[model samples]
Target: MNDGTTTLPWLVIREDDNGNRYRVGRFATRAEAQRTADSLGDHEHQQLYCVERLGARKPGPEQNGTAR
Candidate 1:
C-alpha cells in the first residue's frame, strides 16, 4: 500500500532504567542520531537509541483529561 506519501523523520530516543522511554531529538539522518546519542554519553540505567518517528508519538500514561 504505497501512497507515495512522506513519513516522519528519524529520532533519538532515550530510555531510563525504569523502562521509561522519551524522545530526545529528531534528525534527518541516522548518523546524526548516532552522533547525538554518543555525545550524550552513557549512564547507569540510561541508554540512547535511534528509531524512526513514523508520525507516531512516544508511549506513556494516558491523560485522564485532568491536570496534576
Candidate 2:
C-alpha cells in the first residue's frame, strides 16, 4: 500500500491447506498484525505463518516468522 512506502511497520500472515491457500491479513500496524495471528489459533487445519514481508518488490529478505 501507499507505493510500498509505509509509515508504520507491516505484517503478513497466511494459512495453507492442501493445494489451497488462505491469507489472514496484511496489517499496516503492529497491533493489527498480532490481532490477525491471535485470530488464527492452534488448530491443525489452521496453519499459522508469519512473515515480515516489507511492502516492496525489491524487498530485502523476508523473515520467515513472527516479527520480533
Candidate 3:
C-alpha cells in the first residue's frame, strides 16, 4: 500500500433540469465519460463535463454557502 504512482480518475459533471449540478461518476477516460453522458435521458438543462479530481467537487451557484 505504498505505491504513490496511482492516478486519480476524472469525474463526469452533470446538471439536472433544475440547474442543480453534481458529480455523476468518475471515469478513467474522456471517451468513457462522454459515453456515459450521452446515455443519459434527454433533458433540456442536463449537461455533462469532464474534469479532474480537484474540479470534481466544484459546487453550483446555490451551494456557494453565502447567506441571502
Best by TM-score: 1
Worst 10 residues of 3 by lDDT: 59-68
Clashing pairs in 2: none
The sequence of per-residue lDDT tens digits that candidate 2 reaches over residues 11-57 is: 55554655343455676776677656655654455564564545644
By TM-score, the candidates rank as 1, 3, 2
Q: Select the stronger candidate by TM-score from 1 and 2.
A: 1
TM-score of 3: 0.48
lDDT of 3 at 5: 59
Q: Against the hidden reference, what TM-scores do the models get?
A: 0.54, 0.42, 0.48
Angstrom error of the Cα, residue 29, model 2: value is: 1.0
lDDT of 1 at 56: 58
Model 1 lDDT per residue over 1-68, tens place = 15975433767676665768788787776666667766675544346454544365653435111111
Model 2 error, position 49 (Å): 2.2
Which prediction has more favorable lDDT, 1 or 3?
A: 1
CA shift at 43, candidate 1, in angstroms? 5.6
Q: Please give, for residues 1-68, the per-residue lDDT of candidate 3 as tens digits.
A: 14855443656566555667687777767566656666653445435443434455665655322111
- The C-alpha lDDT values of all candidates are 0.56, 0.54, 0.53
Task: Give the RMSD in angstroms, all C-alphas superposed, for model 2.
Answer: 5.7
lDDT (C-alpha) at residue 22 in model 3? 80
